[model samples]
Target: MRPRFVLPAAFSVAAILLLVSCNRGDLPGKKQLESEQVQASPVAPVVSSKVVEELPEAAVSPLTVEQRLEDFDYMWKIIEENYPFLEVNKRLYGEDWLANKEEYRNKVAAVKTDDEFFRRMRFVLSGLNNGHTNFLSKEEYPWFLESYIRAGLGSEPWVNVFQQSNVLVRYNQKPLTEQQQSPKESNNNVNSGETGSKTGMTSGNVKKVIIEPDQIAYLGTRSFAGNLMEMDSSEIRDFLIEVKDYKTLILDIRGNGGGNSSYWRNNMVPLLINKPITYNTYSLYRGGDYSEAFMQARRLSEGLLPIANIKDEQMPNIPPEATTMFRNYNKNVDIVTPYQSVGFKGEIYLLVDSSVYSSAEGFAAFAKGTGFAMVVGGKTGGDGLGTDPLVAALPNSGYVFRFSLQMGLNSDGSCNEEVKTVPDVEVDPDTSKPLLDQPAIKKVLELAASQ
Candidate 1:
């Protein structure tokens, strides 16, 4: 079985309705809201406005009052059962989503068209304030259902949760890339001056000595979402040989929103080390559809549910009501690095920023958990730990959506989603400078040169 990794979300209300970004979409970089501003702000957007391309509109019909209410209640029930962030929302943002059930019902009841129903779902889902929690687009519903099955979630019931009464007429996966760039431009090098690998985005300009900072081998990417077809392994392979003798290796994933974790496990870790590193991580989730389905999907290999210890210290700061609603989950992932002679053995420094999220956030967590690297930079966008986003569909209308089903907990017992990944050497990203020239990279490079 593939190593169990819990899932990956974005939308402020408008961004989601416009289908601005997707759970598995190729959105580049966006900073998360400051803690002081989360409550009033829209959830951090998933796709970059620079690359916004709309999905084809569904030839959808409006639901009747009965149908609308049924869809509303079904959507609410999905959240109530599987969503893991209810208390986190209440505690962090002062948004009491649990109390707004009827209000959401009224909004759903008030929607007059399929478009209106879609927007209403977006509004309700965005209220959770998690980038990973939102409704799936008509185009993405089938995509997510495929993901759910691929994730090994129990197939019998939830797979049959609702029939696709409205199959999206013209869902094209390549549209975003195509719209963003013509065939001529799409394969061009990332703005970074290096040009060998189009499959992965590592650029050689990352190594240029800037000012006083020492020249460091920079293997950077804005995303790890690159494993659709075989990645040109030669990029990482040949780059490793090029930088093998450098004192420090900079794994710069500054604006990355994460994709395939396998990229790191198969490529980065194995090339760097001769030993295995076991990462013990924890999550908090309800014993509902997602949790239970995943539980069945990957049993005892992870651990049993409803841990006996009732200590408040083990749980993150949330209302007593939430603790009552959820149970603890834990897993130990062993990354066995397969080292080769030309593989990089230098000190690895992970460069990150607030835009580092999802699986990128997982890199930070893994670095911290297993001593894979010294993390340097700002706090990352959270929601890194836990399983893949859980799949759901409204029973009445076959309207599909997904949301986070678990809260990633840090070693210190703080919530990863709330605390984020705090760098060992923290530096706020200065937007005025080029991303690679950020203070953290400069500081760490100077430190790397000295050592």
Candidate 2:
């Protein structure tokens, strides 16, 4: 069963089974009565709707007083009992549920339609001011991902990677190739808009680059929340199989807000080595209430395995569909220590900035603390540790309670539980353009050249 319980944006929930024997002594048809009673309970309505180009104009609903109260009661009950983050809700709303509830009732009454209701709900969710506390429904998740992670076609020729003071800027368009023309000749061609064998290069931001036709690669990872999980390194083995061309790899994690580290550890790590490397043992905390629904689902899943009566058969495993819901369900599981110690000898330069937080900071800290890579850039965003707690809704209002139950720790056993990971190469930026501008790029290039 796709777990009906949700973790919202910033939190992560549980289990139980109850069996009660109904007193059917007086009933003539006991089985039939029991069946009827079982069917009486209601299933929550599914919220699924395609995005409209624009929200419909507000229209007054003809709901009666009783109907409005019923809807209000329904929303309130859902919030109070079902919201995963309890601490957040409790802090925002008070112990006196009735007074706060009445306020929501008035707000709900003022709403003319369902659209207004959800809009208010969104506002209430945003009140937590926590980045992870999103109130998006199932459909909204995919829509948000599609909007954020964009894919482009064709080779961007003029890839200018530079920094504007501190922010990084990646310009599209090939800086005239060696065989093509000199700097002056290319400048003239730009004035005339005439270059031989023109490639349809469009203006775009730089994602990654290999600079100076030499042994240095500069990568600009803006956020860790990209589709790194879906990528398999074997698919791109030919690309990084031999770093013979580039002796030094400058991985610009500058503004990369961390995402799923599993993707980085599993897929990206292998590319660094031509041979296999195993991760050493690391300890992580596990709470007893680490999602019972997930555990139950996992049990049911094993029984339906393809290979019957063969426990040892090495069958290709498929990841659970509900993995995302359990993404933040538990505390630390293991610290990835190299088993064989075949480290990536190529000098690595990690670029970072203030925007890097949570998982991004964790990765940077882990890399530096574990002697993986040297960190560069400005002071980090200072959000290192992450707590994926359950959110419980207020009894009457849209307020949600969020709190952390488990903590993530670095490899050295020092939990970045409260502090941010400071960078090794701390270069202050010019405070003019936004951080994601040319300044970051220039710094990375200059840093690589110096090394």
Candidate 3:
């Protein structure tokens, strides 16, 4: 399925002005008031004047109630037509979807400001209880950093922790440890300079690779985003080659919000297995009026033969050959064969948490099902059942929204979205201490040693 492309918002001038003013020790009372309002109100407060000045002139125009209503209607229609898990959502919400739509539409009509309208629409989308289906308004995009700072959950602490440990770290497309460590200190490792095979390979989503004191190779991958699998594959391949002799490998995907499933199937899985494997038993989508055509087009676009391209005329009196092809096409089993001389022979351990979602959750499910790796840590964020999402933009607000177009079944042919992939050794993080100091790592190490 084609992943939805979310349009990036232009940089907000209002946000920049707010930051500058704050740096200059201005708007102390206003900042406090904004925080209080954010905490008290159901919706986040509107962007302050300081932020408004920084925003582009085009975004300053006030949205009319009619415009907001139109946007709401557009979003609602898209979800109503494209959203695949209506039965699942009905089971979840226990209300008629149409009734819920009417109720939200009435609420949308009453919204006055742009922020209020966005919030109401967001609330309506949240009713589906699907994280894959949601909205992020333009106003919320720029103020994300400010909100994080006010909430006291900035990245400073995490950076400090990694720096203090003197371990190589990469996050947010930057080399954190490389910047902190001296040239002399950095020269001691294989990753310090441009080495053959690892040369020109950007870290991308591979956050950190550190060989622990116990000789267990730990790799923290934050996301499977973009073409990171291809970008970071060489680095991981070379790292695995270098650490091939290590007894254990720890693939930490604690906070990995997944991107592409092909990452695991094509890049990672080949390096871990020596034989052919079937990761998904069967993949099917909800049939609709245009479902056959859609599937045919999708297959053709993906460079696959549209063997199940059943015509409207062929529906009632389908040919025997086409019927067989349709059955085969519907049961789309994902199979992969290992790369020669690239498979890892040592034991593999996967670290996960509730933040492990989307393709990450799929990875965990596959690993557990195939016995490819032993998962350790908390249950996954549970995004495996929802298929690829369809992106739609609001006509007036231009706010982007995504909803799943299909429901995926687990490897075992289960449609249980509520049942998250549990770890083999469930070790929760230590809330009192930093993640680096968590006992979970110790438990993983112990488990590895025992194995």
Candidate 4:
């Protein structure tokens, strides 16, 4: 059965009105407050009589700090000039944050070795308090991550959560590339070994337990990190071909935070089909016509599809077949059907958690709402809205700040900017074990067996 969607006039109008309210804000009042501030400050009166001359622009470069005081001063200036979240920095650092920076710089200067400098930098970066932001200099990071930081997080690696510390926790089907590390022992602990060819082989590196019975296949992809498509396409192809026999499939994207969705269509989905199927799409309107008459007319003229305009990219221009596809103005789309759906005729389940964010959570929300799959897990991390973020590096300091410009909506045109997607079947991690476990695998087995 195809999924159903209906956009009501009242809801659309309300959303538009909300958008209008958000855009037109306290700017006029803020300007008035600024004028009052100028009147109150004694410097404001002196500025009128004094002729201020513009100084020549200074040449900018990375700081060379011989002393800890200089280093701390440099770091504070950089953060104050460029930290991504200004409000957050203010709240955390408070009134005399500069004094703290100077104090830290003094501490750094006291350090006797290069190791101490790195340790100090780590501590300084930690003060930012964002998971996405960190201070791993090019010397410390792998080539891929180094390249990514040079380009920024907008193009970071994707990873699926698999085995953590030698216990199986969940199932992931997304293909991954095994990174090769030098024998000196890499700092990051990623698996680089072969396991048995057993279909339900549990990972010795994982911390949690994930089990798959006979009916369904469970591949715990810890993340969509690195170049899965380019780096390890052959390994993924072989794995998918081997597991193509299963009817019921559970794509454990609970840990997938999304890299490039194109990899799924290319290396993975092609192996599962002998015939083609149409995935629905949605036409998102950024402006105009939230009225019932307009909505009805548009709906009647152009039937609703499952496409989502979360990303700002070109989608397929034509209806996609197995091999060739078209681009849409909408950046991302939820799958109602795979392009080729000849094989694998059974239920699909999506396992999610608070860690499931951005494009990953977007897909889960779509699948759950449209019945594409039975979503099982905890709330997603992101507010499900697409972020159109632009990163800017501070001129004097090499720090970068990213700000979101665009927001996206769900099928009903509801703004998911602040609210995350809640799972249909919420599964909490079992607290009994030192490591948490996902129950979706057990549930999928039971459902498949019953069927």
Q: Whole-model Cα lDDT per candidate?
A: 0.56, 0.37, 0.51, 0.38
Best by lDDT: 1
Which scores better on TM-score, 1 or 2? 1
Cα TM-score of candidate 1 = 0.72
| TM-score leader | 1
RMSD of each: 9.3, 20.3, 14.9, 18.8
The TM-score of candidate 3 is: 0.63
- Provide the global lDDT of candidate 2 against the true structure: 0.37
Q: For candidate 3, lDDT tens digit of each residue in 158-269?
A: 2222223211111011233334543234223423344334557575567545556436787767766433444577777777776666677778877666655555555566
Over 4 Å off, model 3: 1-56, 59-67, 86-99, 139-215, 288-297, 300-329, 385-387, 430-437
* Candidate 4 lDDT trough over 10 residues, lowest sum: 17-26
TM-scores of the candidates are 0.72, 0.46, 0.63, 0.45
- Candidate 3, overall lDDT? 0.51
Any idea what lDDT model 4 has? 0.38
Model 2: runs farther than 4 Å from truth? 1-109, 137-206, 222-237, 242-247, 254-259, 273-291, 294-343, 354-362, 378-422, 428-437, 441-451
Ranking by TM-score: 1, 3, 2, 4
Superposed by TM-score, candidate 1 places the C-alpha of residue 337 at a distance from the truth, in angstroms, of: 4.0
Task: Please list all clashing residue pairs in model 3, or write none if there are none.
Answer: 13-54, 13-55, 14-51, 14-52, 14-54, 14-55, 15-51
Q: Which parts of model 1 have CA positions greater than 4 angstroms off?
A: 1-59, 139-215, 226-229, 289-291, 298-302, 310-323, 333-336, 339-343
- In candidate 2, position 287 carries an lDDT of 23
Give candidate 1's whole-model lDDT: 0.56
Identify the superior model by TM-score, candidate 3 or candidate 4: 3
Q: Candidate 3: how many backbone clashes? A: 7
